[model samples]
Target: MMMNKMREIYGVVNMILFPEDEDPEMLSLELFSSFAKAKERSEEIIKEFIDDYGEDYIEHVTKKNPVAVMGNGDVTGYVYIVKTHAL
Candidate 1:
């Protein structure tokens, strides 16, 4: 079978093209807040995740918009929730 290779590039990436079988899914929770507050909450969530899991599981860059925050379509910052378990 052919393997899917991942590459890192600079600038904004529109999509993640990881294969499903190769990329196992994990449970996560994300909280969105204003740009001014995103980092604070991200740090808090990271601490909580470490307390519960005994380690860090934040897959992407912290305090960045890894996923779109969909609500009223307003552009807001996000804090990605990390955990140790998969569901």
Candidate 2:
């Protein structure tokens, strides 16, 4: 008898925008099969920001696992973001 193996799913990439005076906003970018892919996408977003702003406005880009508390929460599987100012 052959046993079936389960496929692992990696986290997602997100882009977060922080305005100078307004509230911050988040957008779900994409889901990747591996962390490497997710990281790459995150970097790409950062580069895009630099290109647009002519400077590095990013605060941080991180990979995080979302946890559920009593099944009541805004659960985003794996969220990554490039925190920047003024957009």
Candidate 3:
């Protein structure tokens, strides 16, 4: 379910995981800083746009990762998701 705006995305629906999961901790995004930093980064990006193209051209865009990790310690497969942009 990819989306388009400024870029192409592999997600829009099921922003977490599909079919859910047995353990809530497995797919939870508590440890990820990207989601937490999104708002702050968007503010900075918006400011940049506002400065260049004016406020009207600026849009409040948000980004997120939907991957998840399951298991414990080394056995836990940690799928790293990275956001190329962050303020």
What are the lDDT figures for the candidates, one per model? 0.44, 0.43, 0.46
Local error of candidate 1 at 63, Å? 17
- True-vs-predicted CA distance for residue 26, candidate 2, Å: 32
- Candidate closer to the true structure by TM-score (higher is better), 1 or 3: 3
The alpha-carbon lDDT assigned to residue 26 of candidate 2 equals: 19
Model 1: what TM-score?
Answer: 0.28
Please give, for residues 1-87, the per-residue lDDT of candidate 2 as tens digits.
122111111111112232333322211212323566978897998688778765533332343333344435655455444444674
In model 2, state the lDDT of residue 70: 41
> Which wins on lDDT, candidate 2 or candidate 3?
3
1-87: candidate 3 lDDT, tens digit per residue: 232322222231333455453443333433344666887897888687678666543332222343556665444543434333455
Off by over 4 Å in 1: 1-33, 56-87
Off by over 4 Å in 3: 1-32, 59-87
- The candidate maximizing lDDT is 3
lDDT by residue for model 1 over 1-87, one digit each (tens)?
122112212111212443332321111111222543888887998688678656533444344445656667875755454333475
Ranking by lDDT: 3, 1, 2
Question: Residue 71 lDDT in model 2?
Answer: 31
